[model samples]
Target: MRLSMRARWALMFGGLFLLAGTALLLINYVLVNEIVPQAGLFVSNFAGGPGVSGGATVTAPPPVLDKQFFQKGVEGAVDTFRASAMQKLLIASGIALVVTGVLAALLGWWTAGRALRPLNTITSTAQRLGAESLDRRINLDGPQDELKELADTFDGMLDRLAAAFDGQRRFVANASHELRTPLAVQRTLIEVAMADPTATPELLRLGQHLLHTNERSERLIEGLLVLARSDQGLVSRVPVRLDEIVDAVLRSSAAMATEQGVTLASDLEPRVVMGDSVLLERLVTNLVHNAINYNEDGGSVLIRVGDRPALLVSNTGPEVPASAVPALFEPFRRLNRERTASRDGAGLGLSIVRSVTHAHHGIVYANPNHGGGLWIAVDLPLLERTMTSLSPRPGADPAISRG
Candidate 1:
């Protein structure tokens, strides 16, 4: 049977006690029965010996001492001594075994718990862990034993994970910025070509199409950079109104929604949160844009907000499978597997939304609408204090920073 560590220790101590007690008892028994009273036996034999004469056999007169009685006394003394020693040994062993067994059990339990304390710490650290909180460590203090080595190994793993995430974020940011410069130049050239007065109808159409494609590429690159930055960590926290941010994003997206013949509706209750306003605004914008972009003609979008710093955006559009809803938040994952030359979206909208939500320590969920379209909800921590002064404008340039 595989006993627990504490149980094993207890059994070990108990076995040692039993073995030592048995050995000591046997030694005492042997000495009392075999070695002691040898002098009394010699005296009894000398006194009881028959006398021998030359030629004729002669019997010696009985000694003054009662030989039989004296011998019996000597034998009785030895037997009594042996019996007394055996009784005392048994009593002492019983008492000692009970007392020491209890002490051993207690000590074993305490030692086992103390030894496994670091393991418990490691387990809790692993349980509470997430991608953003990779800096947490067991940093166990004490002798460099096996448990300490295990804790140190776990801390090293976390260090490696943190480094990998940082490297990935850096790569994404650099690539996005590098991609944006050429895209800007391309947009400028295409605009100049579109401005040419003598351009044929086909040339004008081609220039307009190129401009749209370049814009979509720019949006995709920017979304990637934003997603990377959000994953890196939140840099600053300021009071932000969910309603105000949503309203602002709605305003920016108003023209696009109108052009698409999508109706916008909102139930913006006062919901204030503490986070990076730019990222929060971007998050809302992404959700709203996705809702607007993937809707049917004359469809409607409902934006609802609550005091819990919660927001839910539901829209009417094509039927979305429940199984496919989760993959919608992945970067560059579109509903259509066949990548047609559609500039409608670059498919990073929901992905950016999810990243920003995570950076702010929030929960986001998505459900496919009953008939058609998608429903997205986000919940963030609410700020306790109401703002009396005007908040800073959220037009700051996006930048990646170390956590």
Candidate 2:
């Protein structure tokens, strides 16, 4: 099993303590029973009266060597001492182990924290960092250890990422501007040709087709530019009334809905959010347009604004496949059958909505309606009430009404 660093350190310290204590206990056992007794006998023999040697007259009689008595006496005393010493050794070893184990645990915890401090910093930095905050760095200051090396590598990677994103934003912005000039020239030339007094019927038909094609190209470029700008993140925020944006979108799309034979319905409540007004308007417009374009004839679109979520757009249309719903937010992705039926869209409507919502730190959800159609809702952060002016309260009308 894999163990965390803290656990590993605790085990290591505990094991070392156990091993060292065992070794000391065994050494004490040997010294008390064997070495001390032998040393005492040698000392006693030297302290006794002198013994007769080499036929010389002995000044004092040598002590009798009573083998059995001496053996019994020494053996009895040694046994008593051995038992007492063994008991003391056991008690001391037990006390030492208990004390050392607790000390080892505390020491291990402190050491582990010291060793993993760098990793904690790295984790916090990564969590706080994103595409918008890539400039923040973990300039770790310490010895040139392994952790320091890892921190350095992470900072270098962030540097590369920030540079790459900057390059992409510049390219998109420049390319969009560059392409607009030629497109404008082409449009002017086509208009001049069509306005000519000598224009033929066949030439007029061709000019109309070219004009439509150029307009589609212009919309595609505009969508790309919006996507790029949204990816750069919002730099400023202001309180924008979501209901006002919804009413504006409804006004603009009323003609399109009428021409397409689709009924429009809405129940918008006054809800204020913090975001860019232009982007929020675009977000609402794209969603309303998509609901109308993909809808069936005589179908209905329902828009709702609430204090909680801010905005929701749902439409009645051909049955949408559950699996294909997620791909609706991807750029240039469209259902082949749906695109073939509706020639006006460039498949960037929902994608732009998603990007703009994300830039404002909001969330968008899409769900396929049971029988047919799609339901999309946007949840945006609300502006604080302190900054909002008070208005007369209206009764809660969560019900959708069609006009």
Candidate 3:
């Protein structure tokens, strides 16, 4: 039902070519009909009969009567000759036109292919373009035309995009140091004040609260920086054991889980995925942290790694509405929660998870649990080498949930 650009172009060119040929063929036929004499053009038809006119048993040639009869005969014979000649001419011309029209169509197809060659190059380049490879350009070289203008415009847009990302990357790179130092200093000051021997109970309580606030601020800033970095995409990729990363994240997250009165469990399979190890760890860490922090006391967090996708994290918490599940992956949506009442999140955990997963060309899916809480699954691409070498007992669990 739908035609590709190349096919459409070829068809258009062929149709126009056929139309011109048809017009020329008709014009030639018409001209021949108009220029030729309709009567008395052929003298051969009026030649004298052999011997003399005969009758009865022998057939005889037509006998001329007066001048009017002779003129009428000549006109009739000439008309017959003209009609025969024109019919032959029309048949021959029609055959030639058909043959040439086919050739013209073939030529149009080839020409269309050649004309669209640059578009193929642009398409392939765009398909491979990534945040890390934004310096690429079509750089089509030819006479100034629409396609040339299009490529140049795309290149210019990429240039501007590359510059803007570079600026954001610079800010994220420096932010880890510049932004965190002050928060660290504030935390240290608060701790020192609370440790003072002469401090009253009231003062110590105030200092302790200040310290908690400072730590929360630090977390918020750190999450923002990670989110920003991940958005720029991975700078490089290497094979990393996703199971191992989950294990490490759980170990680090155990204390937080205990503090929140939540239990941590895992079912890790030996699965390898391609991505930056650091970013992958951050992705797992965020998933685990969110699982623990959002749940009620005595709730449990379960993490699993298997074939297809590298990771899945699930936890029991307050019942999440099915309609409101999409907001979990959104950054700063947690801000609304904090504004109303204090929570242990800066609202960037799942945002980081989604961002890092996308940077690695992976997907995140999430849904509300039947009982309560959420079921989040991350489907990351596995290397063929790893998949064939040590295939997991099998699962590319559907996009059930994301943090």
Candidate 4:
């Protein structure tokens, strides 16, 4: 049978007391048998003369060792020694067993409690940590022991959970908003066309409007899918030139700029980075498109790329509130001033930019431009090889240029 820790400790200490008590009793028995008889013989030898009479000397020499008296004296001495030794041993054993047993029990309980305290905290915290109560954390204010490490790990898990839940909430809200826009437009167009059946031109216009709305819906869904894939870390990535991506975005944004009467310019320097080229291109394109779409008439858009690789796209537009800047990269957050603009987007542009930048281990922020517009800055680490290729060589395009 197996014994519990406490029981084992008690038995160990009790056995040690028993062994010590037995040894002491045995020592007492031997000492009493040898010493008592020798002392009796010495006393008798000193009391009796060297030539005492036979009867007196022989019969009363020493009562302890006399053959006639030997049995009785030895028996009495042994009995007395046994009684005393047994009594002392019993008392000592009882005291030692009680003291040691209590001490061992207390020690075992204390040690076990100390070892399992963190586990208890973990269990309690886990029980409380569900979908509604993810913010609860374990108390780690103890020594830097294994339990503290365990608490730290638990805190990390809670952090991850909180981030994941926040992401999920944002995603759902954004998807709903994006989906609602096209559905609302389609419904309005259908109602108008039905109300004016006499005008074929209106009907045709409404059909075109519905088609465009459907296309927009499709695009939003596709964007959501891409964002979901990116969140899942499923996108294939490879090394692509950062400058190439900027050039591509600038070319794409030029047509939009011409339509808006806004000039789009870029100063892109050659630099390489590791990422999915297609996504990076799309990310840059979205930023440029957003900047140009929201710019004022006759406004200018600037794009810059170089070491400490950055893309600053600023345009002349109405100022955004300083407090609202932090939420600009959050999905579905639209500026108050732009709420009335017909070109207000689905509000996922900056979110996509942030997500893509995060995937590449980069940061993007928005700040007020000096000329009364917003500046979106994307800063990413430059790859080692990109630094080596920075020097201008003969017959090569200048290291930096604006086009």
User: Best TM-score goes to which candidate?
Assistant: 3
> Taking the tens digit of each residue's C-alpha lDDT, what string does model 2 give over 31-96?
655544442343244234453322232232235856456556655775677577778877887798
- Give the distance in Å from residue 353's predicted Cα in candidate 1 to where it truly belongs: 2.3
Model 2 clash count equals 0
Q: Score residue 387 of candidate 2 by CA lDDT.
A: 27
Residue 222 of candidate 2: its Cα lDDT? 86
**Model 3 residue 243 distance off true place after TM-score fit, in angstroms:** 1.6
The C-alpha local distance difference test score for the whole of candidate 3 amounts to: 0.80
Please give, for residues 1-403, the per-residue lDDT of candidate 1 as tens digits.
8886666766776677667766776787676456444535544444556533222233433578676777677567656875776688668866776777677667767877777788889999999677667778889998989989999999999999989987887797689768998999999998888888998899999998898888888887788789888888775677677778888888888899999999888777667787889999899988898899899999989887775549989999999999999998888788865445456567788889999999888989999888899889998876656544445335422222211
As a whole number from 0 to 100, the lDDT of residue 34 in candidate 2 is 58
Candidate 1 vs 3: which has more TM-score:
3
Candidate 1 stretches with Cα past 4 Å from truth are: 1-109, 124-137, 235-239, 307-309, 381-403
Clashing residue pairs in candidate 1, if any?
none
Tens digit of per-residue lDDT, candidate 3, span 273-387: 8889988898998889888888989998888888755787889988888777788788877623763233556777888989999999999999888788887999987677645
lDDT against the true structure, per candidate, is: 0.78, 0.81, 0.80, 0.68
TM-score of 1: 0.65
Instruction: Sort all candidates by lDDT, best to worst.
Output: 2, 3, 1, 4
